[model samples]
Target: MSQFALLGKRRFAPFFWTQALGAFNDNAFRNALVMLVAFQMGLDDHTVSLYTNLAPALFIIPFFLFSATAGQLAEKYEKSRIIRYVKLFEIGAMVLAAYGFYTHHTSLLLIVLFMMGMHSATFGPIKYAILPQALQQGELVGGNGLIETGTQLAMLIGMIVGSALMEIAGLGPLLAGAITIAVALVGYLSSRGIPEAPATAPDLKFNWNPISETARVLKLTGQDRPVFNAVLGISWFWFFGTVLIAQLPNYTRINLGGDGSVNILVLTLFSIGTGIGSLLCERMSGRRVEVGLVPLGAFGLTAFGVDLFFARPDAALIHGLNWLAFLHSAGGWRIVLDLTLIGVFAGFYVVPLFAFIQSRAPREQLSRVIAGNNILNALLICCAAGFGLGLGMLGLGVPEIFLATAVLNALVALYIFTLVPEFVMRFITWVLVNTLYRVRIEGTQHIPEDGPVLLVCNHVSFMDPLLLMANLRRPVRFVMYYKIFNTPLLSFVFRTAKAIPIAGHKEDPQVLHQAYDAIDAALAGGEAVCIFPEGGLTADGEIAPFRPGVEKILARRPVPVVPMALRGVWGSVWSRRDSGLGRARLPRRFRARVELVVDAAFGSEQVTAASLEARVRELRGDRA
Candidate 1:
């Protein structure tokens, strides 16, 4: 189903609106307060600047101080109930904000701002952690995409609404306060519709000390090296975004020479692009948590960021161009395109990382891991501010700063991809599989969400493993023939994916023994392993007799064995049928229709080589 279909389901829709409304109110309240202070209060420039500078710190401090505690709460209590309570807290905070607005008291409004920050900090863990429980494995990427799109659009709308409301004569603050209160109440009402998401770790001992819990949660986040790096990648995204967003206003005034409307125009373009890119993730990933999009996103970010610099490096020749005037000016649409594409790439970069963390992290500890992620995001946001400021102090122009950051993004992405090669490996697989074939998967539910399972399939073509890797929600360790494992460019992917290289006994006895050992270890450690029980690819479009290697591995490990088949891959470019008299035949079709049929797993002791071969052949059902 389309991800939009989720918006109609009771399981998802309420929670979606609930979070989106909260995001809207958060930005609305903050921006409204900024407008009141900067315009309505009649304060000196120094005082106004001080208050504005202090506001973000107040808001973010809660994440630093309370995130671990909030994580524990999410783990120990029901999420829906907590969300309701959070909404109630928001209503109360907004009431205080209304009073503060009426009296024009900056200090009181700042305190309310801090309360809202605490509100968000508390909600942070539940925001992501609840999705895993409420959503099916396939719905995960789509669900996250919706949340991202909602949040971005809500934030942008909230900023615009809040600022516009506060600009109204005489009753601006009152109107802003009223709208915030109403939104908070509506947010609370929405929360009531959210289905219960039971605590992941009930009856667990609670940790009350923020400092120690913070350290402990960080340690927990780092326990998985790849997950930790994924967290870091998420934080880097915030850093990049913070820098880009922080400079946007000045970039509008100085570089584009556009008025406030033009500023809004650019922001709108970026936000819309982000929403588009986010919504596209589910379709692009084929409903899987495909991290390959990360590399693609990173490349776009650097490419456009550099191009954004080149598109308009110097100041505008004329001043005070309205948004329309700016667009009608030379090179305007190029600038717009650059910003929009950057947002699109930003969406591509972030959505998968969120899904990856959600899918890969331990369920019981997922909340805490997300809390750790929030803390790092907060830290990186601060760093981005400093980074932009430092660059400005170093006398770099805004465009130069953008260029420098883009270059740094390339470096950081390279470092992260190198640290976890799985991301790049998956990217290559996703690209190849999606480009070459239209893949259809059946009975994915037959593949267990967790634990060890041995997957046995007919080897129809060289792309079998990559195809499976791209489609399966869970990661797989493929056992391929040693010769295929060592294929030059593909070898890096195999090694990074930790594929086991096996050979026929006559070809290499040691390699065969090592492959068996690796298979055993992987299964013992509760991982899925796929082996082509045909021992090699089919010479014709027919199943070969199953080898006993699978039985041998199961005899040692005795995991459940899932039978699978690849259909309509027989005549693909990489298949044996495409090799005509030692010359490669041109692919008969591009994006050929391919289906992966999976059957229920059988108990290890329930099957033999003959029975397994029959089941796979049956599943193949006349399709090669």
Candidate 2:
């Protein structure tokens, strides 16, 4: 089903709109404040700079002070109720905003900004934590995509509408404030329709001290390295985003030589492009949490970012041009494409990381993990801002900053990919599997979520292990002949996955004994291990006779044996066909349909070499 299908269900739709509306209001209010302080009020340069700097600071400081507490609250209370209360807080904040706007009270308005930030901090944990409760495991990537798409688009629209509304002749601030309140009210109403999301840690005691709790929350995030790294990756994305967003107004004015409309046009293109990429993730990723796409995103960010540098030079001049004039100017279309692709890649980069974190983090601590991510994200954003300031102080222009960021993006991505080759390995596997053939996995749920199991399957092709490793939800440690395990291209994958390499007793009694020992140890430790009972791939695309190795392994460890079969790989290019590689050549099939059928596990006492082969043959039937 399309991820959009979630919108039709009460489990998701209400919460989606509520979150979108809140993002919209936040951006709207901030941008309107910016417009009023910068362009409309005729403040001096220093004063304008002061408010511009203070606005973001005021908005983000609360996250540092409150996210730890908010994480605990989300864990201890019904999330939907917390959401309702946060919306109430937003309403109260908007009320204060209304009074400040009407009375032109700058202090009061800044206070409202701080309140709105507090409101966002309060919702941060609940917003992410509630998703796992509302969404199924398979739906997580799709759901996260939709949420991200909504947020970017909402931010774009809200900024435009809020600033435009506030610029009206008389009662401008009043109208903007009213709209903000109205949006907040509707958001609260939408949140009411959300189904209940019970707390994952209801009995947890709340800690009142922000200092110690914040430290504890951060420490909690580090408990899972992959998850914490995902958080860091996400924070890196925000760092890039913060820099680009902070630079946009100045970039549009000085570099692009465009007016306000062109600025909006740029923002719109980037936002919409990101939405498109976010929405496409499900299909491109084959409906899985594909971290492979993250590297693809990183590549795009650098490639297009560098292209943007060349597309609009520092020397270009088109002063005060409107959107139309800017588009008609030299290199205008290229600039637009660069910005759009940058956003698209940003979407690809961020959505998967979010889904991965959500799916992997422990349910009980998901909120606290998200809160830790927020705190780190806030810190990284500040660092990004500092970076831009340092560059500016060094006599760098905005475009130069883009170039520098792009170069840094490449270096950082390489560092990250090197640190975690699994991401790159998965990306490669996903691409090859997706491109080489259509693969369907049946009875995947038969694979236990945990514990040891001996997986017995018919060896059909050279790619059997790759197929099973790539597609199966659970990790499977395969026992294979050492020679096959050491195949040139597949060796890295095998070693990285830690596949157990064994040999025939006559050929290498030592290796065979070691393999048996390793298998026993793995099972004893509650790890899943798979073995091909056929001992080797089928030369003619038929199941090879079952070997005694399966019986021996079972006798030693006595674990559940899952019988599996691969169908429709007989004549494929990768499979051994005709007599020899240099003779009897024939046309190779492209993207042949392949099915992996898994049957219910045979209880330890029920499985034998003969029974597993017979069951697999039955499952394969005539397809073999």
Candidate 3:
């Protein structure tokens, strides 16, 4: 089903609108305040600068102070109720904002900004934590994509509408105020339709002190190294985004020679591009939480970012051109394409990380982990602000700042990928699989979401492990012959994936025994392991006779055994179709159609080498 189908379901639709509306109101109010302070109030340059600079800090402060507490609240109470209360708080804040707008009370409006920030901080944990409770495992990525798409568009629209409303003469503040309050009310109404989500940690003790709780929350977030790295990756995204967004207004004015309309045009293009990318993730990932896209996203961010700098290296000779005029100028469309792709890549980069965190973190601690993510995001955002300011102080123009950020993004991505080689490994696997074949997967639901399972499959091609890795939602450790495992160019991926390499007993008894031990240990620790009972790849696109190795492993560890088969890969590039010749042959067809069929798992006691091989052959049928 399309991810959009979630909009028709009671489980998702209400919350989606609620959150989207909340985002709309948040941006609307903030941009409206900016308009009031910067343009309408007639403040001096320094005072305007002071208010502009202070706004973001005022908004972010609550996250640092209340995120831990909010996390606990999300964990200890019913989520729907909390959301209702949050909306109510938003309503109250907007009411006060309406008063401030009418009276031209700058202090009161600033206080309202702080209140809005508090609203966001309180909502952050529940925002992510409730998704897992409400969405199925398969829907996680698509759901996240929709949420991201909604947020991006809503925020963009809110900014435009709010600023436009505030730009109106004599009635700007009143209109902005009314719209914000109405949106807040609508958000509350939509939230009322959200289904109940019971707390994951209802029995846990609550800690009220922010300092101690914040420390504890951070520590809890780091418990799972990969998840914590995902959090850091997310935070880095905020940092990168902050730098880009902070520079855009000036970049539009100075580099593109565009007026305010052009700035909005750039933002609209970016937001639309992000929404497109977000929606494409489900199709790209085949409804799985695929981290492989992260590396791809990182590469695009750097590539397009550098291209953006090179696309226009100097300020325009003309100033104050409208958006349409700017588009007609030299290199205009190129700039548009660069900004849009950056946003597209940003979507690709972030959606999977969020899904990974949701799928991998302990349910009880997920809320706290999200809260930790928020806190770090806020900190990185601040740092990004400073980084931009520092560059400006260094007399670097916006284009130069873009260039530096792109370089730094490359470095940061390299560092993260090095720390977690699995991301890179998966990227390689995903790329190879997607490039070589159009895979149709069946019966994946039979694969357990968690726990140890032994996967037995036909040994048809060298690309089998990677194909399976790309398709399966959960990670699988494959057992392969040492020679294949050590193959040049592919060894890095194998090692990073922790594939167990073995040799025949006659050739290397030590390696064989060690492989068995590793397999057993992995299964015992609740990991899935795949092994080809045929012992080696088939030489002639036929199933080789089953070997006894699988039986031996299962005797030692009586885990479930899932039989799997791959079709149409027998003549592919990595297969042994050219074993009789000197070199591998090119595929007769590019992107050859392939099928992966997984049967319901057999209980350990019910599986034998002969039976499992027969089942795999039956699954493969005459497809090869």
Candidate 4:
């Protein structure tokens, strides 16, 4: 479906505009206030720095203080109603901002900034949690992509428009105030059109006390390890972004030797790149929540960050050279390209992660989880500011700080990837599947969204597990033959992924027991564990006789058994039935189109070897 279809759907369109307009107004007013206090007032450097630092603090502090309560409110009342009220609050806030600007009251201006932040804080949970309610499971990636792209673009335009308006001789404050109120009113109108979204947790208890509610929210989020970890990953991205973008103004002036034009150039390049990458999420993800892009993003962030540092011009800043002149200078274009690509990679990395969290989080508590995310984002942004200040204090120039941040990003990314090898592993699998074939996954809804799941698929090739892992949003532990599990090079990936290596009883009784124990433990912990029932690759390119190992595992765990089949793999180079004699030959580029078909789950009594084999054959259809 086209991306705009999401807007026409009663579920998504209203919320999208409401959120987009909110973002636009937030940046517009904030930047306008910053310009008034910093440049127009002709404040000293120390005072300007103080207001600059306090602006973000005032904005973010509300998230930490009120997100818990906001989350509860979202879960208790209908989202449309709450959004309308928030827009009203925005109108009042903008009126106060206009007053502050007219009277030249810095204190009132800062208060309005705080109120703007508070408005955003209240809207935070609603912004993210509303998507899952509005979008079908298949549309989450596309929906998230559109939102991300729109948001970044809004931020870019808002800053530019706000700054431009603030510079107008007599019309600056009046225009900004008028624009802010208009946007707020439009957001309200858009929100009124939103269909009623019933509360997910109607009976959720209200906690008025921020301290206790914040603690409770954090504890609730901790219940889902993957969800909690995903939140951290998102928070970390904000940290990285805050540090990089905050230094751009100085970097442009000192290194690029461009005046105000460089600031616009940097913002334009970064925002455009991010918008492009965000839009690509739907296509790259195959309409699913493909987090493989996270690792890909990390790689690009580090690569371009390093290249940007090295790409800096050696000469000092020139007084009169414009942005065009700077670009025409030696090595200028490379710096621009590097910064733009870095932003592109960042977009690729973030969109999928957001979709993953939204799709996988429990429906009832999605708002609270997003609230937790907001808290962490606030904390990380604060830390980024401190880190940047410390670096400057330590005599690190802006360019040097950029270099340090890039190196640190690499280290942090490595640590996160090591902790969750699934990120890297999935990237590899996604690349192979996407490059070698067009993977069309069907019946994915049959797989349980939560709880212990045992997937049984025909092992057609060595890459079967990777293919399945890439397609499934939930992580799974694979049980593999000991020999294949221990293969050189691949073993590292398997081991890092913590896959279970099993051996036949006749070959190694100890290894067999260990494998079963691991599988049982994983299932007990509510993880998906996949096994090849045949216990070996298909020998003749046809469905092999059913093996009893799957039955035995189900007998012990009694979890829901999901039967899946991979078609079109038999013709791939890794297939056991490859026509080429001893060694298999590679297939033509993009010649293979693979499909993973998931069938309904079966109970223990309903899933013997015979019954399960019939189910698999039916799913495989004539291809089997």
Over 1-624, each residue of candidate 1 has an lDDT whose tens digit, in order, gives 999999999999999999999999999999999999999889999999999899989999999999999999999999999999999999999999999999998889999999999999999999999999999999999999999999999999999999999999999999999999999999999999999999999986999999999999999999999999999999999999999988999999999999999989989988998999999999999898999999999999999999999999998778899999999999999999999999999999999999999999989999999999999999999899889999999999999999999999999999999999999999999888888999889988899999999999999988898989999889999999888889999999999989999988998899989989999999999999999999899998999999888778888889899999999998886888867447565656568899999999899999899999999999999989
Tens digits of per-residue lDDT, candidate 3, 514-571, equal 9999999999999999999998889888999899888899899999999999999877
**Which residue runs does candidate 4 get wrong by more than 4 Å?**
2-4, 42-50, 313-317, 451-454, 492-505, 508-529, 548-562, 578-580, 584-591, 600-608, 621-624
Residue 125, candidate 2: how far off, in angstroms? 1.8
RMSD values for the candidates in order, in angstroms, are 1.1, 2.2, 1.3, 2.9
**Residue pairs in collision within model 3:** none
TM agreement with the true structure for every prediction: 0.98, 0.95, 0.98, 0.91
Give, for candidate 3, the lowest lDDT window spanning 10 residues: 580-589
Q: How close is candidate 1 to the true structure, as a TM-score?
A: 0.98
C-alpha lDDT (0 to 100) for residue 574 of candidate 1: 89
How would you encode candidate 4's per-residue C-alpha lDDT over 362-430 as one tens digit per residue?
889999989988988999999999999899999888877878888888888888777767677767778
Residue 423 miss distance in model 4 (angstroms): 2.0
lDDT of each: 0.94, 0.87, 0.93, 0.85
**If both were scored by lDDT, which would come out higher, candidate 2 or candidate 4?**
2
Steric clash count of candidate 3: 0
Q: What stretches of model 3 exceed 4 Å from their correct place?
A: 581-584
Name the better of 1 and 2 by lDDT. 1
